[model samples]
Structures are given as C-alpha cells and as structure tokens.
Target: MTICTRFLNQSRLWKWSVLTVAVVGFPWGVGTSQAGFIGGEGTDNPSRQLKALFAEYWDDELRAGPLEATFLGDHRYDDRLADLSDAAHEARVKRDRDHRHALEKIAPETLSADERIDREVLRFTLDDRIEGERFRDRLIPITQQDGIHLQFAQSVNFHPSATVGDLENYVRRLHAFPRVVDQTIALMRQGMAEKRMPPRITMAKVVPQLRDLAPKNPEESPLWGIVAKLKDWSEADRDHATVAVRQAIADKVSPAYAKLAAFVETDYLPACRESVGLWDSPEGDVHYAFRARSFTTTTLSPEQIHEVGLTEMARIREAMEAIRKKVGFTGDLKAFFQKLKDDPKLKNQSEAEILGRYRAIFEAIDAKLPDLFGHLPRTDYGIRPIEAYRAKAAAAGYYYPAPEDGSRPGYFYVNTSDPTSRTTYTMQALAYHEGVPGHHLQFSLAMEVPGRPAFRKFGYVPAFSEGWGLYSEGLPREVGLYTDPYAEFGQLEYSAWRAGRLVVDTGLHQKRWSRDQAIAYLEENTAVPRIEIVSEVDRYIAWPGQALAYKIGELKIREIRAQAERRLGTKFDIRAFHDRLLSLGSVPLSVLERFMEQNQQTEAEPQR
Candidate 1:
C-alpha cells in the first residue's frame, strides 16, 4: 500500500544487515527532496521523461521481487517467489546495467532540481548495487546470522493468510521452497569453490538456524501453522491447505532442507575459514571498502573509520565515567560496567513487564511528540515481544512499518529471549528509537507524504534511517524520559555502546582483531550482557561495514542540528526544522545537509 522502499522481495530483510529490524539494510530508498518535482525554468523540462524512468524502474524492480512486493503489502506477486537460479542472477545484473545506461541518457541539467537529486540518488543506488553484484557476494548467500532460510521462516508474517486464496498461494510457495533452497546451495558451493566462505564459527551458527526452520512436517512449519489467523477460511479449506502443505514439505521443502543442512554441517562448515574478519576473503579489503562507503555513504576508509571509532569510544567512555561517579561508584569504569551488568535492579524479570514498560514508554513519548515535531504522522504504531521463534537471533528491538493504506499498525518488536539479561535501562532509549520518534515517526511520515515519486515515498537508506533512529534516542533525554539515574546511565551506556561499535566493528574487519577481541572491547566499554555482546560482535563479523552506519549517520545528523541551531540562533524552530527534515522523507545525510542549509537561508531571508 505504501510505496515499498523496503527490499528483499528477491533476497532481502534477513540478509540485509539483519541487525535491527527497525532500520534494516542499506540504500534501498532515500528520502525525497524538500520540494517535490516541478518544471525547471525552461521549455526543455525532461522531468516528465525522468519521472517516467523512475516509475518504470520501481515497477520492474518490484515485479522482479515479488516477496519484497508482498512485504510492501503489494499482492501482485503473493503467489510468486524469486527465481534464484544462475540465470536469475545474470538477469538482475543485466537489468541493473540496462537501467544504469537508461538513467545516464537523462540530462540532469535539463531537469528540475528535485529531479536532478532523484537522478543522482538513482545512479548511486544502481552503481552501488552493480559493484556489489560484480563481487559475486550472492554466491555466499547465508552468513552465520542471515540467509534465505531465515527469510523463508519470516514469510508467514509478511504474507498474512487472510483468505483461502492466500493460503493456497502460500502452499504454492511451500512447493517452490525446494527450488529456492537448492539455488542457495548451488550458490554456496560456488562460494566454496571460490574460497569465499564465511568463517567457521559463524557458519556453525547458520546450520542450527537452518535446522530450526527445517521442520520435517507441514504442521510444524511456521508457514502452515497459522490456523488462528485465518478466521475467514472454512474447515474444509483449512484442512485441504494443511494436507497440501504437509505433502509439499515431505517432497519439496524438507528434502531441500535436508540437503542444505547436510551441505552446511558436513562439508561447508569444515571448509569455512577460522578467521572471522571479511578482510581475509578474496580481495576482501577492497570489498569491505566498497561496503563501508555504500553503507556510510562516505568514502571513509577502514583505517579512518577505525580511528574515528577509537576517538569516539574514548569520548563516550569519559561521559560514562561521569555517570559512574554520579551513581556513587568508587571503582573504575570497567568495574562500574561489571556492576551494571550484574545488577539485579536492571533486570526485566518477565516478558509482560518488558512489553508493558515499552508500551508505557510509547504512550509517554506519544503525548510529548507534538512538542518536538511540527508534522506528526496520522499513522499509529504498537509494541509487541519479538516472536519466540526469531527472538533468539533478533537484536534489542526492530520496527515494522505501517501499511500505506493503514490496514496494519506499525510494530516495534522487543526481544525477550533472555529476559533476565534484557536490561530496562535501554528500554526508554530503544522505545524512542524503534517505537515513536525513532523509526515509526520517520518511516510513517515518509509513507504519508503525498504526490511524491513512489520510490522516494517508500525509501530505505541505512545511514539516514538509522541516523535518525539514533539521533532520536537522545531527543527523549531532552524531553525528560530517563528520570532514574540508572535509566540515565542506560541512555549514556547505549550511546557509549554505539560509540564502541565504531571501534569494535572496524577493529574486527579492518584491524584484524579476533572475535574475542571484539567481544572483550564491548565488555570493557559497555554494560550489555555477555550473550548479547557475543551476538552483536558475531553480527559485525557476519555483516561487516553495516555497524558503521549507525554512528556515522548519527554523528552527521547531530552535526547538522548543531550547525543549524548555531546559525539560526533564536530563529531555530526545532519543530519546524524537524518537520522540514521529516518532510524530505529519507535522503542521505549529505542530501539532508544541503536541504538543511538551504532551509536556513530560506528562514534567514527578509520577510516578503
């Protein structure tokens, strides 16, 4: 319903960063320009042709990715899954090449300013995608944490079985599962042949995940067990669907899973490298460089990112020390972190308490949102625990967008997998980030924008989205949410944790730090639990360069806000500035900066 800027109709979501569901993946779509497309000051307005090109690209890309479309709530491809064979890969490459050529033909100087920005965004998206494909990373499809199998498991949520036809369509997907799984196996074999395997420890995790999803019977499968959600279906229809699903699992799905599980557990796992860093892969340094640039939307090298991370880590630690002193802790910062980690006071003993606290945080934040934002989304959102099936693998919390038509409220999934270890300190910050002013507000506002190109309306840029999410975490501190010192400490700790990421991520992938080194760094610098630290570090190893986006994006946003406030002084209207920023949808930080400066000028000019 809302223009789906989200990716993975082909092979997205789970594989694209898969770190935080709130703002997943890289550069699927960016925000629209503050001004919508209008004819430039000439008769030669190629804006029409350019807009047509974007429409064509969106339509073709969506059709090529039916699962992605379904996730976007487009039912056109509900019955279809991606063709993940060798030919499909080639087709995607050619499609990108052709689109790049088509876009190159459009003269930017002849178009309006907004169209030129769109032109630039389209070119960047295609270029990054083309370069990534050239590396043939698709051959190494499943990492320790992400792969097609996880996507298959989550498709049930993406495709609701509201009607009997929906159930039938899902059964068809079940039958098609073997083909997708087999293609993935072939890709893995190719990756192995090329010596591009993920590290062994990471791969070990992947096999267990595959086992979790590979139910031998249809009744046990997530896809076939949604009997309660299908209230409209008759008993006969449900029974027929159930029987077909079981048979499909017996013949197609289970056998395919068996083959994959065997390939991974036996052959591939042994073949995987012991080293966890991506820098050790074939031409890995170069590949990592491109990814760093793509995710951060900057050409900062691994060395530069590592240095920045170190500097930021030290700075955040100093602030954490201040908090440690505030809490009357006599020992050093590491001791304080250890105490925070062990403190029973920080625990949310039950899932209901965790979810309930998040809901209350949402309500409190909701009432205060109008004070900060000039334009608030009409769309509402809800809070729920991350499903037990995926909770173990999911991050602190993830956000799901509301349908463009408002058929579904947006969802913020709080992970309660290890409840005793799930601290309450981060809940306020996480709630702000995933629920209200963070993802739901920014994403819903983008979807609610009227008359924009479909692509911009539903865009997903990692730096922009995640930057806003992180930036939002601090906004609540100003609004007075973290009342308790521990909660305030949690807020600082969360920020410090992100700062640590800048160091640990770059240290692992670039500096050749071992997985243990990465884990120890977080342990020393933040109060996050050991298991959570292990999971986060593993994610960084599995998906290099992605962790760089949050801090990089947040720093840029805070810089812009600071500069704007400095320049505008008393004229700086936080609400107006925020509304203007949200109005631009999801542009890159650089694009955001330009518009922010331009807006300052607009405000500074004498009244007409």
Candidate 2:
C-alpha cells in the first residue's frame, strides 16, 4: 500500500498475531530448498507441487508486470512499462488459462491442511483475478484515485538508479512512457465506446492532476530525482546519463503526457458519464456487487452492508460520546468534534514535529510488543511522510512494506501535505495502524511464513489485510499506549470515521447518494477535518466497496478474538492466538475464521 492508494491488509496472531496485502501468487517457481517442506521435484507431494507451481508462476508474472517487479526490487524489467493494449489483455487471458489448467492438475484433498489453505488462497485469488479481467479493469484505464500516472510516479521513485546502467534503463522506460499513455488513451476511448468510463466528476479532477504531472523540461521533472540521487558516478558516465535523461523527458516524456492530457480533456471528458455511481453504467449492478464481494471477501450485498454500516456507525458513536464527556468537553458530540478540530494543541505542528511524534509512538510500541505479541518480524521498519508530489491526492497516512530482501525498511508515510489541516492526536493511532504492529510487521511476517506458496506469502486479501490494520489501531489501548483520554478519543474517532465509510461508500455507489450528501453524512458522523472528509468521500466514490474492508474485517477479527476468549478462557494465550492467526498469511476472512475456529479446539500451539 502506497500513500497515494491504500486500504491493503497484513496478518500476525489472536491476542499475539498478520500484512493483509492482496497479492495473487502463481506456483510456477516454488523450490524444495525453501525454509520448510519436502523438495522432491518429481514427487507427487501436493504441497511441493503447489510450491513448485507458485514459484514458476511468480517468476513469469514478475516478468509480465515490470512496474510490480520494480516495486518488489526486481530490476530485470526496469526498462519497460506494461503494454496496456488488448493484445496484452489477450496474452494475460492465455496465461490465466494455462495457470488455471495447471492448477486443476493438483488435487486439493490430497494436500495437508496448511497446503489446503494455501491451495484455496491461490484458488480464490485466481478466481478474483480472472473475473476482474473479464470486467476489464483495463477497460477504463484511468481513475482519479488509481491509474497509470500514479503507478508510474510511485514505481519511478523505487527504481535503483545506482549506476549509469540503471539510469539508462529508467530512461528507456521514460522513452516508452508515450506508448503506454497512448495505449491508455486508446483503452479509455474504447471503454467509452463500450459505455464504460469513470464518472465525469472524477475525470475532472484527474485531468488537472495529469496536466500538472509532466513538466516541459526533464530537469524540472520529479522523474529526474533518481538521476539527481546518483552521486558517485564518473563525470563522463554522469554526463552521458543526464544527457540521455534530458532527451528522453523532453522528446518522449513531455510529449506523452501532453498527448494524454489532450486526450483526457478533449476526448475522454466529453464521453465520460455524468453519473458517479456504477449503477449508471452497463451491468453496473452486477459490477458493483462483484466489487463489493471482492473487497470485503464476503457475499453480503450492498443493502446488507449499508445496514451493517448504520449499525457500526451507531456503535462507534457511543464510544466516541463516552470519550467526549470524559474529556470534560461542554456540550454535544458535534460541539466536542468542533473543539477537537479547532483545538490549537492538536493542530499546526511542523512536519518534523508531527513525524517525530509518530516515530516516538513506534518506539513505545516496540518496547510493549513483547508483552502484546509472542512473535515479531526479523525485518525492521521506519516512519516518514508521503512524498510531496503525491501527498495531495493520497490519504493522511499509509504503509509501505519493507523490501523482501530487507535492503530497505518498510515505511509509514504520513501525509504532511496539509500539515495545518492534519491532526496530531491521531498520530499514535495511525502509527499503530500504519507502522510496527500494523502493516510493516504483518507484511514481513506474511512473507516470512514457512512453506507458504508464493501467492499466500506475497499476495493480498483486503478483508484480512485492511482488517488487521484497523484492528491494530485499537490494539495499542491494550498495551496502555493510549494513556490519555484525548488519544483514546482519537482512536475511537478514527474507528467511527472508517465506520462512516460503509454508509458513505455504500450511499455513494449503491444507494445513489450524491457527493455532497456523502460528504455531509461523514461530517455529521465522524470527527475528521473538512479536508479529509472531501478526500475520503472522493476516495470512496473513486474506488467502490474498498472502504468497507477495514470495518468489516476489524469486526470479524474482533469476533474471532471474542470467540477465542470465550472458548479458551484462562487457556487463551493472546500471543498464541495472534501467532496462529498470522501463521496463515493473506487469507480471506472466511478462511481465517475457519482456521481460528479450529485453533480454539486445541490447548497446544496450533500447527500450520
């Protein structure tokens, strides 16, 4: 999860444990030498077969998604952008068919329980991906929230420009940017022909963002920041690289962005639907239902979810009201919310001060983690602000997983873009959710899980991952981390804020509420400032059904813990339950429920 787009999940155990990143892994490259499991290549062992299949598929898929590879620190495809044409989509279909056919070759009943879990994780992930392909996510290639530009911008930053060779490879991608942009334009127009375009209002916001992205000169571009970071290059090598980069940005990059901007303003905008909800489009009901099920990992309908959201909003508001009176605030919840918003102590902190606050929260968390969790990741993480370029469109904070090789630490990106408008009281809660016991720990542990197929290890399930992060926000109170009522209030406020998402997100997409109505609903229900309310409402509008994951997942996780506490009684080891839950990385919530239920039956450490 990047600062610009988040809501991904991670795993750890019941009182003790999970990154619920929603990645799909193919089993083509698994090897017997990995930490645990039988290695006989030709042996009929189902686990080995699953591992081998995933390993091989992972390798192929990595090559296929170059930007994904770059983010993962694999540089083999650094010189290229994804080919977003129909041909590429067709090729993906062919690959999916081959992978599915091969997967059908493995017998799940013959596999161990753990392998069976892995098999199902892989199975469902493929099902989701294949169904998504049919929906043609590529059909409408751009959105205000997610699109090629942000992907390119974010991926560009992660490129390791350690050498002139690296610089040249990156320049090659910059040179190829026009073709990708052109392909996206083609897809957008085709989507329009198919009566599928992102809402006009969303596109209106996107056009300006895209227009602002590419500067006329490469030297002025953020794309050159990587080149600027290369300090040790020989003068001749540096000169060669800089010249090539300048030329690429001037001749290819600027023109590509120009072409894209022109297309969006001239062609795409006129064709974009005036309606915001998916219901206005072809097969909109079915599409929104698929998205709802996909993100929540539950078959619950929008109406059901809307009802659930209302219930949750009421529950969280009661917690918030308790805090309001405890804080000695005079008047009603809304008045307290206004005071919380205007309280000078909680706002206007310098970016450094704000960041330092979060870092301190993490250090406090580190000291208490042992008391709270039985296990921890070997890889460490750090806190930072979102890069200036993306901070405007991005959420207030998000987690970036550590590199698999541990070359770099995981990051909790605080959006200091609008520092004055941001709240400091939420830093501790945000830190718990975005740093340490939240995303970084969960993601690292997921990757490190022994004998997990590549997909289960690195892939994502939103309900699992996002739920864990949301669960984590409340976890710090157990460690006495939210020592003050104000801090505790921040936790409850954020919880209600997410709960409000269900109402707002569902209201926007399924109930056919207008943007203004959604914003007003959030303002009435949650304590976030006006700025965040706007973005949160827009985020829900841009990406349907995603916001539901945090609360839905959190409730399920909380329910699991409650079940364990009820059944295990004095035997309920918080650490053990947490560890067992996390041992299965990136699982669907239903799967996690089954697994945790099975764990409750045993007094001993549950085996993976």
Candidate 3:
C-alpha cells in the first residue's frame, strides 16, 4: 500500500453519505499511529491506546443489538432488539460525544503519522456523528433500497435459522418490530425536518415494501415460514411461538407499518421534493460533495467524478462494441443489448435455482483461489436467497460479512425476485463482486489477519473495501476466469454498471439532474434493466456520493497495480501482489500504496 503525504487533520469531518448499502452498515474501526499495527506508521504508542479505546466504544454499541450481537458471533444479545426511539438515538450520540472529548486530551504533535491518520479518522467520524445528531439524518431514512424494512427481512430470514433459542430470539425480534418501525419513521421525520428526506422517487417504493412486510395474515408472511423452519421443536411449542410472533407482528409491527404506509401514501408522498440530487435538498449539495470525498477517499468534486464516469464509459463502450462484433451481431450496439435482454435462456426460473447457481459459482471460484491467494479465510460461506419480502427491491447480490467471532458464516444473498432481471450473462461478475475476489474473501480475510487491531479487522474503508471488491471483478480475467464471450460481456457489463454509477450518481446529486435524467443516463450507458437502474438512481439521489466509490476505488487500485508491475518488472508476482493488498485488510488507498511500495523494496533486497 502507498501512503500519501496529505495529512488528515482535525478540521475535516467524515460524512455518512453513502446510500448504496444503507441496510448493510459499515464497520467503524479506530486505528492509531503505532508500530505492529496493520497499515500503521510504525510509531506512536498512546495513539494506539486510543485506537483500542475506540474499539471498546464501537463494540459496546454493537453489543446492544441482540441481532447484531448474534450476527457478530457475540451471542449475549441474541434475544433482544435495542430500543430505537429518538431518545435512544440521542443517548447514543451523547456517548459518542463523550468518547470524542475523552480522546481530545491526546495531542497530534505527540502522535506518529499513522496515529495522526487514526486520530483524524476518529475526529472526523465523531464530529460527523455530532453534526448528524444536530442536523438529524433519521428523517430522510426511507429509501427504495436499503433501510430498516430490508434489514428486518434479512434478520428474519438469515439470523433466525438453526437452534430453538435462535427461533425464540427471532420471535422476540418480531415482537420488538413495532419499536423498530416507529424508530425508523421517527428518523425519517427527523430527516424531513432537516430537509434531508429521501428523494420522492425513492420514498415512493417504501410503501409497497412496508405493505409486503406488513401482511394482514401472519401465515402468509415471510416471518411465518422462517419460524416454521425450526427443527426438533414441538408442534405445541411451535404453535405457542407462532401465536406470540403473530401477535407482535399484527398488533405492534403491523400498526407501525400501517402508520408509515399511510405517511408515505399521504404525508411524505405529497411533501416529497421533486429534486433528483442531494444538492437540491436542504444543505444537500454541500453535504453530497463532502460525502463524495469521504467515500472515494479523494477530494474530487462531483463534476470531476461525472467527467471521470463519462471517460470510463466511453472506454468501456469501445470494448463492449468489440464484444458485439465478436458475437456476430451485425446490428448496432443498442439492438444487441435488446437481444440480450429479450433472450429467454439468460434467466433462472426460481430463487432456489438462482442461489444454487451462485453456490456453484462459489465452488468453481474457490477451486481457482490457490492461483491468486496464498492465504484464504477458513470461515464457511453461504449463498442464500434474499428474504421474499425484501428481494423485490434488493440488489441482485449482496454480501454480509461473517460474524466477528466466526459462529456465523459470511452470507452472499442472491436476489431472485425476477430471475430474468438477474441474467446469466451478469452472473459471473456478480459472483466475483460478492464471492471470491470480492466481498467474502476480502472482508473475511481482513477480519482474521493477525496483529491488526480489532478495529482494522472490522473497520470499513469504502475506497479500500468496496474498491477492492470492484477491483476484484477484473482480476478474475487476469487469471483467465472470463473465458466465454458472454462471461467477458458480463465483465464489461459490470464495469459499465459501476462507470454508469459515477455518471448518474453525480448527475443526481450535484448536477440537479432529474430522476428521469439519471435513469436515462444508466439506460443509455449500460445493459442493466430499466427497473434496476431506476431503483439505483433513486438510491443515489437519497444517499449521495456513495456511487462514486466503485469506480474511484477500481481506478486507483488498477493504477497502483500498473505502477507496481512497471517498477517490479519480471519479478512481479500477481498472487503475491494481491496477497499484500488484501492481507492488510481495508485501509485508505494512500496507505495501500505505501504498503505496496514497501513490498517492492522487500522483494528487491538480496536473498540471504
């Protein structure tokens, strides 16, 4: 990894602006400048202590979530859901402020370079949280894609499996659903007051999802089957548990959902702003620009990102045209895209079959891992279907990192709502993005690496984390994974998708583009279906600056790789290079470059 001289200082604030994976939260790790730490500056001891302190604060917060605790392999909170009221959120903010003040005693002059970076990260995150509390982000909480509704669906589907206790916890969570829903609405209202509401187009989809999740008949609900799946439990116990869960669902969860549904239908829908970009919202433009810098870990403006996206799109379009020719399509590229979309053979019929296909892809990808990585995660991984309630709006695939303690495997959820939407041509890239060389391998590796602070293991660096995932997509072809033309097209399609994100995300957030304008940009530029593009565009509008991470990270990683290859000459080993990159877990791109440079020097030294 390369280190940059640009020092992050106390003046900067880290913003939580990425909207792409809202339901999927990011890991907040604290790192300080110190020797013997992953991607550290090899100096500054007290900063290291502070880094440890940050973990305590973060882990304590996670411990409060019964489901999160279980998901993190910390089983103590398995039967509870943390209170989600406004007061609860306020307390959380105060705690963070307290932690921030406590850390302020340590001076930057006393710290090492890496410690300074960690301090900056800590200060930025804390300051951002404080600002967010002051400004309130919860009001604009609903999105067509990620949010509490989707997360609830996931918890009901994924975390409740296995033991009778697990089943019981699921029921408790169901009972707690009312508070959760109410809290979400409260947050949304808070955001609304701050002019931070989710885009009208995005919030439009929230009502249907609420309706889907808030089924009148509990028997027809997604939770009903998840509970029904419990094994070795008695029929009477099951019956009793079912009644309790249903009561919670109907009386509590459903009412809140109904209220929110009404809000969306009546209040929010009418009040919904027509603006497509975050810039149009209250303090939105500035907020989005800040968010862009935070997520890309670069100071590039939206205009710069927009231009970058256009440049990349043009480059990929040329490659796509080559594929079109190779496939013997005499028609224009647009016609070829239509042909691919209309093909019946390109899709699966059922969710199970879609998931099974992903599972097989995982196995195949696993077999080839030895060629690229010297180290691999021992934790098991699963390819599962998204819960029925949320699948309709979920991404084609998403990875849930393995629990911190390793009890639960990392999960890659394949959305099979409309199998045709998850086309066969796109499967390889999806597999790459979510499975090996993508989320699972990179995340699991980061969590287990020895000598790294616990925070680094779980800390999310979007530029580094998601960047690595996007970068991994192209790495498979480097090892000959995209042999088929269609698979190659899939690779291009995925690349096109990320590139398109840059355009539409910027267009929606900074350029005052309409929702339709953003949607049209994606449709014109990529092979993604219209609905997916529309859903994604709305996400960018709600979340701002998040869409920039993929291409930004990919471009940086590729640049570093090219530089390394040029400098190392014939001695460069692709597998070792990748190992060095991933083994440090997720760090800023600058830190990554420095690490890569050190590896070059180490490799260059005389063999003793």
Candidate 4:
C-alpha cells in the first residue's frame, strides 16, 4: 500500500504508541527479559537503559500525538486531536533530536543483540525525521491524496465509538476540528511565504474534497456515521449524544471544512507551483536525494535505481510477451495491454461482484497459506470499498492494519468507486497484495511480534512493507493459484506497473521528466487502466521517491530468498524463511540484510 507524505509524517508518531494488550510471546523462543523493562534507571545496564529510553519515547509520542494514539487503540487520548500548530512541529523536531542524542549516549556494545538492533532502528528513525526537518515538510501538509480534512472525514471508521464516553470523545474531536483546520491553514500560509507549496493541479483536487466534506446539514456530515451507530446506548443518552454531535458538526466541523476549502481555492491554490518535480523546489535536488535514500533505505542514487528499473522492465516485458503468445494474442505487447483494458468482459459487473470475488479469492488463498507460511497472524482482516470522498485520489487499494488491541479487524479497502473500471484478472493479484500474504498478514504479524518496542512493531519501512507486498503477488503463482493465463498476466501487469514506478518516479523527479511524459511511459508499458495510470503519476508527483520502494524492495527480498535457497539446498523451508522475515517486523533493508547474513546458519524452526 502506498502512503502519502501526510500519512507518512503521522506514522512516525503512530509507530511509537505501545499496544494496550499483552501480545502473545513469539514461538521462536526469543527471550523477553528486556521487554519487561518499561521504565526506571538503568545506567549500569545498557540494555535496560535502552529499553527504558524506548518506553519514555513511546509515552512522549502518545502524548504528543493523541489522534495517532487513538488509531493504535490506546484510548487514553481519544478526546483530543493532534496539535498541528508550528509550536508542535518545533517541539517534535526537538524531541526527535533529544531522543537521538540519548540513544547515541547508550553503549551499543553492552546491549544484547536484540537491544542493539532496537537501538540502531530507533537511531535510524530519529535521524531520518531530523534530517527531514530542513525540508519543511510540516509546512506543506495538504496534498491531493491526504490532508487533515480527509483524515477528519474518515474519523468515524478508525475512532472508537462503542460506548457513551467513546461517543462523547468522538463528538469532542468534531468540536476540535476547527482548531486543527486553522492550524493547517496557518502552515499552508507559511508554506506560501516560504515557497514550499504543492503543485497547483494537486491542490485543485483538494478543493472538491473539502467542499464534498463540508455539508450545510449536520446529518449529512461524514461524522454523523458515529451518531447513527449509537444504538446500544440508552435512548436519552443516545439522543443527547446525537444532538451534541450534530451541533458540533454544524457549528464547528462543517465551517472548518468550508473555511479550509475557501483558503485553498482563494489563497493557496493560486500560489502553488506549476512544476511537478521536487527538483523544481528550493534545495529540491538534495531533498529528493534524501527521500530516495530514506524511502528505499539504501544509498543508491536515483540514476542507479532508474537503470535498475529499466533492466527489470525489459525482463518483465519479455515475460509479458511470452504470456501474450501463450494466450495467442494478436499484435504487439502494447496492443495486448490495450485489449486487456478495453475488454468489457474483463471488468466486474457490479461493486458487489467486485467485493464478493475478492472475499472468495482470499478464502481460497487462506486455506493454502500454510503451504508457504508457518506462522500466521491471529488478527483477522476484511474487505471494504474505499470511501467515495477520497477514492478518486487513492491508489488501487491499501491496507489499514488492525489496532494492536484488536478493536477492529484490518481492512483491505478496494476502490469499487467505478466497478466497471475494476478489471477481473487483476482481482487476484490485488487481493494477494493488499490483503492476505501481503499487507494484512505482514502488518498483523509485525504488531504481534513479542518483546519488541512500539516503533519496531508498528513503524513502516516502505521498501520492506511494499517490497513484501509486491513479492506476495508473485508468491501465489508458485502455489499454483494463478492458473489462468489472464490471471498470471494480471500479476505480471502489476509487476510491470511497480517496475514502471521505478522508472516513472525517478524520471519525473531526477531526470526532470514531465508529468505527461511519465504518464505516457506508464501507459505504453503497463496494462494498468488509464485512470489509475493518471492517478499514480499524480501520486508520484505529490510524494517523491516513494514509488521507487516497491520494485527495489521486491528485488532485495527475492535476492535474499534466492541466496537462502542456494545455501540450504533442499533443506531450505519457505515457511520458516517467511516466518523469520516477518518476525523481524518492518525494518530498513540494510538491517534486514545484516540480520539475514548473521543468521544464515541459524534457521528459525518452523511452527508446528
């Protein structure tokens, strides 16, 4: 699942909130002595010192980012929203710097191997965030894909409203909307003065979303969903909560959205830059270089990545040509792509058909999961249509991991916004990537990994997570799932799409390729629908260096697996290999490679 810059920024805070429930111990026999050290002085014991520091940082993070806390199922701060003000941004930067300083002072040599890994992960996270401060990301928070407005509109889905107090907390957050909106506008205004605005075209997309979110009638507001679901409460209590929620929506939330829309259309949109690439902005080259390194968790320059993309695309094209010939398709590979896109029979008949097929696909995939994975997540997942308001700007699909408390199941949000545009063959590959054996499986297992700090459990490294997702699409083929040539072609199409991202993203950013040029390249190369290709290009424009993570990550993962297979000969177990990878949680590519090298001789025993 691709993440926007706003979501990425918030994820740093979200990653640090500790789960409220006790996670089941990992079956691999990793000792949990360090996990028990939540706080206290541990100057003499570096392991204890590092764990205590992690605990402290976690607490600070939750306090600083209450919304993120709520998302993590830690309800202590459910009544509050995050501080989006400049002071909050400054404080966060200082806190990250301080944490890094504290981390560096700890003696890594004195800690256990696990604690050392934690120290390095935390250090890397801190340095990345600190380095990002110079780019002034906080100023340009609004984007076509994500922003404060869109997050608030979807609050009812993620925010708990099971009880009266939860309902009241939801209402309080509604009341708090205006303040956050104003804070966002202030930041955007500052962005304008500093010349750090988003592209005018992307900002144009935000205007309609804000207008759609801001309704004159309170009952019509998106936040009204919570009030509508208060059936368990006493009638009088429910009535009170309903009234309060409606009033908050009418008086606070709607106006706030309307105000934001006005500001964007009248003030900010006009000031937005015409150029799309990061290279066009001040210090953009340096910023793009940093993002490329940070997102891929590698030091490879954009030129090297672009060439890797070109090579991979060529290989994938050959594979696609073989598939086209296998299917007895006429004309060139591009013609085959066009036929795939233009075929009405390839499209879903209705949204229900689209969702129902995904459910069936996952059910079949779940039964076969044990053939490849020894350890599976206890947390379950479900499929849902992407909410209409933001679906146009969103990706094909994305996974939202269940809160560690298991208050809700993880979700794979499919974009059924235009059902006919949803092709039939792509369903299996998309399902595998976004749902089981992809994000839901990887993320749920990560959250359950025992004795890890909150950051390690919940933090996302795009290369690892997205790489795993891309790798998952192809994993099913080995299990003989994609039997139909069209289905296998679908998988290849998605692979080509990700491979295309490596080229298109760098092309737009580093090579200074025009947005149209990137779009044309993707159109000619991949079988992805035209609408999605356009959306993806704009996404790359809005979030630089992120698109490079998928193929780069997949290639690294595949490389490691190939090495393992070669070393272990017939003894190599795919299930154990998968378990070990998931057990590490989401980490840097470098960290993952180092772990694999050190543990090459010591394999994780397969779970019975």
lDDT of 4 by residue, 1-608 (tens): 44222343432442232233223332222243333333323445776677667766775676676666665566777888889877787787877887787788888888888888888888888888887778887788778876678767766776776678788788888888898888989889888899987888777888988988999998887778887677887889988988898899999999999999999999889999998898988898899998899889999999999999999999999999999999999899989999999999899988899889999999989999999999899998888888888888888887877877676788888888888898999889888998889988888898887788766787778888889999999999888899889999999989999989889988988899998999899999988898889888998898788888899999999999988898788888899899988888878899998888667656534546
Candidate 2 — which residues are off by over 4 angstroms? 1-45, 604-608
From the highest TM-score down, the ranking of the candidates is 4, 2, 1, 3
Candidate 4 deviant stretches above 4 angstroms: 3-43, 603-608
- Per residue, candidate 3 scores C-alpha lDDT tens digits across 63-102 of 4444444444554455677666767766777667766775
Q: Which digits, one per residue and each the tens of the lDDT, describe model 2 over residues 1-608?
A: 22223321110011011122222232234334432222233446666667666665666566566776677666777899887778876776666666676677789888888878877776676677677655655677666666777777666557887777788789889888988888888888788888877888777877766776778867766677777766788888888888888898889887777788888899889888887787877788888888888888899999898888899889888888898888788799988888889988889568888887777788888999987778889878877777676567678888777656666777778888868888878777788887868877677888877656555666657788788888988887887888888889888888888888888888888888998999888888877899888877777777777788888899999999998898877877888877887778767888999988986776545568
The weakest ten consecutive residues by lDDT in model 1 span: 14-23
As for lDDT, the candidate ahead, 1 or 4, is: 4
- Name the 10 consecutive residues with the lowest summed lDDT in model 2: 8-17
Best by TM-score: 4
User: Over 4 Å off in model 1, which ranges?
Assistant: 1-45
lDDT of the candidates, in the order given: 0.74, 0.74, 0.68, 0.81
**Candidate number achieving the greatest lDDT relative to the actual structure:** 4
Reference-based TM-score, model 1: 0.92
Sorting all predicted structures by lDDT, with the top scorer first, yields: 4, 2, 1, 3
Runs of candidate 3 with Cα error greater than 4 angstroms are 1-48, 63-67, 104-124, 127-135, 158-171, 234-239, 349-353, 605-608
Error of 2 at 64 (Å): 1.9
Model 3 earns a TM-score of: 0.86
Name the better of 2 and 3 by TM-score: 2
